[model samples]
Target: MPISDFRKKKLLYVFNVFFDVNQSGTIDRKDFELAIEKICSLRGWPSGSPQYTKTFDSMITIWEGLKKRADSNKDGQVSVEEWASMWDEYAKNPDNALEWQTQYLRFMFELEDASGDGTIDVDEFTSVCSCYGLDVAECRLAYQRMAEGKQEVTYDQFVALWKQFFTSENPSDPGNFIFGKTKF
Candidate 1:
């Protein structure tokens, strides 16, 4: 489906948050967590909250899935260069934006599957946090929540939470342009 203009703007805000850490127009592993934290804060979610844990797990899962597809070199890590390359390739397709978004979700799924075993465990969740620069305490909280019955996060739940957290308070304001849409 074609993303609404609002969703496009919202997604853009998210993309910028992830891509422009330090406002340097460049993103690295360190910046990734900052971006995630920023999104969490904007959406009224505490970084270490159970709600945040589920959302973060979902995102990591998607990232890992996308990495498997984008990391053609099989290096086990997707660098900035690889990300750019993937984006470029996707942009050339007729359904460029949609494909980009799909890839993004897939990547998150993969990130959550830290063990590459198609399932996310507490250890795998923590490993994702470490990759994104989360400290031990923060990572622990995430696992604690999951172990306490939070379980795995589904794509729809993740998307709903993302919309709630990232969308601007002013319904009509059409806020930040991070990912390329507001309702993604």
Candidate 2:
């Protein structure tokens, strides 16, 4: 099953914020590359080093996926309009939607699990959630539910949570906690 329109849009909105690294009101492959470069620099990764290949490759893979799917104009880039409107097209096709969701989860986990520990700590969780414009305090509470008393969320746990978040419509599910409290 595909996620609800509201939930799916919320996911896209968060990703749009993260991908638009330059705040240029658009997102493209260059933005993903720049984001990786900055992230590597901040982590003290050496220039021209191979240590950052996994991170860089993951971003490139995601960019390719987005371009192949969401670049409606075939213009070799994804505009804000294309990002926002792609879900409307994907939602009508459950198989395509699920494929995107699964692939997206893999990409996001690779990005957020910065320590290569196969888990996301609170700080990482908070940083990812912030992109969605979700309040920090509310995210704090939601993190607890998602973490389920653990200090971090493992890839398996994250996958289960994402599956629920993507496919379930019930508000009571912890997956609904992805963005914390939704304000009208």
Candidate 3:
């Protein structure tokens, strides 16, 4: 089956609200730079600090990978159609996910685990969501759903949900809240 409308909307949230950091209609190098700036700012990683430099480099690497996979037209931007289509292909054959895709997932999980305790607590989840311009209250609820009554989410559990976020079509899947609740 093709990508579901449900999945598409979630992907749009990522594309429009997350990756398109400059409110641009397409994903490009600038967006990645802005995102790096935001993340570093949120963490108070001053310029020239190890954290800042690492984040800047990591985001650029991720941008290169995303551009390779989604910039089919080679127009220097990844349009919404290309973004959704690339993900649609991944949804169909999740086991074939590229290293970059898994790398992105790991990066996001590490980003949200602010305490660095190997698990994500509700507070940590809400804080990162806020950094990304997501609704904190809604994020709290989403975190609860994702944690499934647990006090924290382990990296292993997060990896499982990450797969669900990409591959599952079920609306009730907790992984739908990976980035925050999707508008139905």
Candidate 4:
């Protein structure tokens, strides 16, 4: 089955905010490369450093896995339709998408949890969003809604939100704010 319009909107937010870094209207290896560079830069990992090397390798592995799973037409790029279709499947049978999704989620959690304290505070969430060029104020509000007045969100909590972001189409789901504001 195809994804609902609401679900597609949420998925598009994730795609545009994270995957389609180059704004190329499609997801490809270049987007993943740019993502690695952006993330490494945000973490202050100089290109020759071990951190940069490990991040680069991990991102490449993620890209390879995404392309293999989502690039259904063998076109070397994932179009919007392809992305929507992939998520549709993920929404149905999560295990089919678990491996790459888990890796990606861990990477994102690490990026957002700047203090390395195994949890993400509202400040860290806002800071990461600000670094990503999102509005800090809006990010704070979104975090409030996502955390439901909690001071911090642990990795397991974030994992639940991540799952909701991928699987739920309900308008009230807090996971919709996982990427900050959504269109609907």
Candidate 5:
């Protein structure tokens, strides 16, 4: 599928966040989350919410996916140098939307998995919202609903949810986008 204008804008914002933190075109896990948090704060997201939790989960999912292709050093963590290498590889072939989305999902997961504990906490949840310009309370409600039947959203589930939120035919439906805004 062709990339939507909204998705392009969202991806560009994400890229800008990456560049802002990894100005040298490199990023460690901490740097990555910090950048996301900064972006979320700029976007006016509340300090806590289910939406934030979902965002955090999404970051982790993104990192996990990227880990497959970018963790060439086998260090179990993405270092700044490794990120530079990965970014180069991505830039060389930026047209692959699926790859880009997968990488993004993993990045989201990493953001949520603060403390490197492989699980999300309240603070991490708030921090993720602070990066995505979301309202904490509103996000929490959404996250609660999304996670109601499941303890955690898996990678594939994350992708499906993200696609529904960002690329669905009816973006205006609050039932569609995780955060409610159609344009991301």
Candidate 6:
């Protein structure tokens, strides 16, 4: 099914408002750099730290994917129109969206699974949520629901959350909390 116009609008709003942290009116490499920097600072992972280097690289890789998958005009930034086009296509074919989201899910999971134990505990969850400017409290609840009493989140579960966060329309769904404190 084609994604509703409203859903597309909400996604775009998130990109324009939160993802475009530099207020550049478009999603670009600088915006991504600023975000990664914030994450590193908050985590106290300074330059040369393994986590910092890995996260920085992963974010850059993700940004590259966004450019390849969504930067239609290919002018070096993802304009609203380009984003809309990619999302609209994904809305029409959710599987296509998954193909794009899976890589991100793996990289994000690696970044957040700080323990290196292959599981995502509450602290890890909180750190990642905070990085995204999401409400940690709300995400706590969501994480509980996802983990379902498990101490760690499996990669399969992480992938499922990625799918749900982007594809589900019900705002109350736990996956909706993936972005943290969304206005919609």
Best by TM-score: 3
lDDT of each: 0.49, 0.68, 0.86, 0.85, 0.52, 0.73
In model 6, the number of clashes is 0
Q: What local lDDT score does residue 110 receive in model 5, on the 0 to 100 scale?
A: 60
Clashes of each: 44, 0, 0, 0, 29, 0
**C-alpha lDDT of residue 11 in model 6:** 74
Answer with 1 or 3, whichever has the higher TM-score: 3
Enumerate residue pairs that collide in model 3. Answer: none
Model 4: lowest-lDDT 10 consecutive positions: 93-102
Tens-place lDDT per residue, model 1, 27-58, is 44445456567546644679789857865765
Q: lDDT winner among the candidates?
A: 3
lDDT of 3 by residue, 97-153 (tens): 877788888889989998889999999888888788778888998998888878999
RMSD of each: 12.5, 4.0, 1.2, 1.4, 10.5, 3.0
lDDT tens digits by residue: candidate 6, 110-183:
76787778888888887877766677787677677666567788787777766666667776665554554444
TM per model? Answer: 0.38, 0.70, 0.96, 0.94, 0.41, 0.79
Q: Which stretches of candidate 6 lie over 4 Å from their true place?
A: 13-18, 94-100, 145-151
TM-score rank order: 3, 4, 6, 2, 5, 1
Regions of model 3 farther than 4 Å from truth: none
**Per-residue lDDT over 109-182 for candidate 2, one digit per residue giving the tens place of the 0 to 100 score:** 86667788898887777665664466777677778777776898889888777666555556567665554444
lDDT per residue for candidate 5 within 13-92, as digits (tens), equals 44444433655444345555665566456445555766466555565566666666666877666554454455445434
Instruction: Point out the worst 10-residue segment of candidate 5 by lDDT.
Output: 173-182
Could you tell me how far off, in angstroms, the CA of residue 70 lies in candidate 6 after the best superposition?
1.2
Candidate 3 matches the true fold with a TM-score of 0.96
